[model samples]
Structures are given as structure tokens and as C-alpha cells.
Target: MEQNKTLVTEFVLTGLTDLPGLQVPLFLVFLVIYLTTLVGNLGLIFLIWKDPHLHIPMYLFLGSLAFVDACSSTSVSPKMLMNFLSMNHLISLIECISQFYIFASSANTECFLLMVMAYDRYVAICNPLLYPVVMSNVFCTQLLGVSYIIGFLHPMMHVGLLFKLTFCKSNVIHYFYCEILQLFKISCTDPRVNMLLIFIFSVFIQSFTFMSIILSYSYVFFAILKKKSAKGRSKAFSTCSAHLLSVFLFYGTLFLMYVLPGSGPCENQDKMYSLFYTIIIPLLSLFIHSLRNKEVIGALRRIMKINSS
Candidate 1:
């Protein structure tokens, strides 16, 4: 797996904006986002660690989600922010590939972790009698380990295949950051195999995880309907609203990014939608789940009280 001719050692990233006047403003905006993402995620992790009430499987998954979200944003946002300030945003061949590998791995892990959390909620609501037995600490740990394994496994395959490609043409990437789809476009070699592999893995992982979440929630809805007390039903559904909304936003963007038709008139729009999946959705997780969590708020209050005393 060697290149016949090394055409380009580095690539110029056409960042989110080209306007010379708006560069500094955009940098500030993204800087704020990056800081907020870090604080929200780390705060969530700290709360989960400190609070004894949050020792359940659901919170365990939530903590894992926060960790993945933090890593995913950190992988891209720093470089993107740097690009905004610099005149030439050049990334080396090896560095670009490494960025894509880490970003994809973390993003995939978050997807599976979301599904696992949905299942946890379903078992807690629908099979309350067996929730403790079905999802013990050992079982949750195994699920997390499997989630990370599956996440990294598929991306490594594509990355290894990418090393086989011959990049001997233009060295300008149209996006704000490095991505596999964008990289595949510039390859001088036949990328049909890589394209097919991407399609298969994307469809397989998304369809499987989506189906699992759907089935779990279906059972949850049925169980909610069976409840005699309206209050109980409302409380149960309330807890699920946040998770359901997050699933919709994430899966909606992801499906549009990978599964939708790209050769049609909407190709550019497809790329824009992909930004939501890669960047915006991860930011949303901070606000939608962790920032508003009751446990996190309680932990903050305790920390404040201790400092005051």
C-alpha cells in the first residue's frame, strides 16, 4: 500500500468562511462554543462521579455520552478555530487522516451509547421488575466496552484502505475540517471499494442502532399506556422526552448526511446538513441532556454550599 507518486504532502482547508472581515468574529463565536462544550461535558462527568443517586445504568450511559461528546468536539473545533485566524490553514496528510479517525470513532461511539441509554430507560419503565437484574453494573460495563470497540473497528478499516489511495491532484478540501467522504473525492485511485464499504457500514450501523432504539421505545410507550395512574404515565413520558428529542435530532442529521441521495440537485444542501451531524448535534447534547440535568444542578448546588461554608 504505497503511492506511486506523492502528489501533495499537505492540504489547504477552506474553512467555514472566506470573508476577511468576518474571520475574527467567527473565531470568537466558535471559541465560545468550544468553551461551553468543554464546561458542560466536564461538569456532567463530575456530577455523575460525585452523586451517589446517579449511580444507575442510565446516568452511567449519560456520563459516557458526555465524555464522547467532549472528545468529538475537541477533535475538530480547535483546528477549525485555528483556521479562522491563520491565512493558510494547512494540514499534513498524516494529520488529516488521524483527525478523521478520531472524530469518526468518537461520533460512532456516541451513537451506540445513545441507543444503549434508550434501552436502559425502556427496561426501567417497561420491565421495572427485572431492570436491576437485566442491566447490572457488569452488564453495563460490557455494553460500554462493546460500544467503543464497534465504534473504532469500522473506521480503522476505512482508514487502512485510505492509505492505499493515491492522492495526486488538487490539495484543497472544501469543508472546514477533514472528513472521509471529502478525502475519498480527491483520491486518484478507484474508490468504488471504499465507497461500497462506507455505504455498507453506515447502513448497517445506523439501521441496527435505530431499530434497537425504536423497538425499546415502542415497548416503553405500550407500558406507559398500561399504567393506571395518569400521573405515573406523565412522569414516565417526561423522563423520555429529552432522550427521544436527542435521538431524533442526531439520527435525522446522520441519515441525511450518509443515506440520502447525493447526485441529485440537493448535493450542496446535503453537505450543509452533514454539518449538523458532525458539529451542531454534539453541541446540542450539552444543552439538551447534561446542562439541564437535575443531578448536575444538585451537584453544583452542593459545591457552592461547600465553598460558602
Candidate 2:
């Protein structure tokens, strides 16, 4: 299959920038990011598991998200860090594809997890009485199962479709990772079909999840307003605000990158944007959602107390 489809066996990635001045600084910066992401995400998952108070559906999804974010960051950052430290950015065709597969699946899985979390919130707020029964352990497990199944399955289609394209344009990929658009640019074969499929997939996945989250929150908004107590309304706002911010940050960046074409913050903006979503987003997720939460804070205190005792 490869003999026919790909002539560019080993592609050289033009790592972030060609400037020698920024290499060490960028390396140091991303190094800190990678270490922080790993520790924070893994620590959050452990915190959730160790704390009995966090055994609910929301925390379950949160833990899964931390897992997926860790996976997403791992798939790209190690290679990116290595590339930053060394001049060797050469990756085999198989390696590139495998890397994207992992990253893409992790990303798609994140979309689903966020969607399910939104639904969890919907049930809890909209159907307050039924939420306990509806979002029971068994049901939550099933939801998680589906989120992962679809998450993994979604990228297989892209990779399968990608394999059909032949690459002959140039072996130098101009981004940090084997990004889909970068791949399409190098393919000698017509990537219109591939682009179309990607567009369709991106639109469907993002829109469906984005719209569902919006709808859920819309209902949640009204429900919050209907509450008699000002404190209850204010508390609800505070609780959901963080979740909504994370959602907007993830979906917003993705939407802009895909829909707006060339809106990067600077030259070689693709690399910058990719770094943001792939590396920075994971770190942001922990702070924007889990770390800011009162419950997570309480759980941390409880765990610390136990360890100290």
C-alpha cells in the first residue's frame, strides 16, 4: 500500500522556526509546559480517584478528560520537545501517521467527553430529581464507553482516507506535527476528497458538540434563573462558568483555526496555533475546570490532610 501511495518515506519537519536564537528558549518553555501538563493532569486523575466525594458522574468525566488531555499532550510534546532540542526533525511516514492518529483520537475523544459532561450538567440542572437516577454509575459508564468508542473510531476514518493520497510535492512538512492540512499540502494526489471529508467531519463533530453544549447551557441558564434564591443562582453561575469557559476556549480556538483560514498570532501561525491546542489547551483545561472548582479544592485539602495524618 505504501509503495503506491507514498514516495516521501521520511519527511522533514521544519520545526517551528529556522532561527537558532529561539531554539533553547522555546525548548525550555515547552519543556516546562510538558512537565507541568503531565504532572497536573495525572495528579488530577489521582486526586479524583482517591477522593470518595468525587465519585459522581461529573468528576468521572473530568478524570477521563484529564486522561485524554494527558494523552493528547504526550502524543505531540515529546517529539516536539526533541525536535526543539535537536536539528533532527525527520519522521518516517508510518511514525507521522501514527502520531496523528493518537493525537486526533485524543482530540476527538475530548470533544465527546466535553459533550457528555454538558449533558450530565443538563440532567443535573434541568431534571434535578431525575439526574441522580439518570446519571447513575452504570449509565455514566455507558456514556464514557460510547465517548471513547466514538473518539477512537472518528480518527480511523481520517487516517484511512489519508492513506489513499499519494505524497510527492515535497518532503518538508511546515508544522510541528503531521497536521492534516500540512499533509494535504504535500500530497501529489488530489486532496479535494480528503479535504471534503475533513471539512465534513470537522463541521459535524464540532457543530454537533458545540450546539449541544450551547443547548444544554441554554436550558441550564433558564433553570438557574428560575431558582428562588439569589445565592443559588450566583453559585450556579460560578460553578458552570468555569466549565463554559473551558468549552469556549477549546471550541473557540478550533473553530477559528478551521473556519477563518490564516489567523495565527504571528508568522508560521499554524505552529503557534497547533502548539496552543495540543500543548497549551491541556494545561489550560486543568486550571480552567478542575483546579478552579471548589470541590476539587476541597478534595485536595482532604487528601493533604489524610497524607499528613
Could you estimate the TM-score for every candidate? 0.94, 0.94
Candidate 1, residues 210-246, lDDT tens digits: the string is 8899899889989999999999998778767788889
lDDT of 2 by residue, 1-309 (tens): 546654878899887787899989999998999899999999999999999999999999999999999999999988888998786799998999999999989988998899899899889888989988899899999999999999999889989988898777789998888888888888988888888877788889999988998899999999999999999898788867888988998887777666554666654666667778899999999898877788999999999998999
Candidate 2: regions farther than 4 A off? 1-6, 259-267
Instruction: Give the clashing residue pairs of candidate 1, or none.
Output: none
Q: How far is candidate 2 from the true structure (C-alpha RMSD, Å)?
A: 2.4
lDDT of 2 at 58: 92
lDDT of 2: 0.88
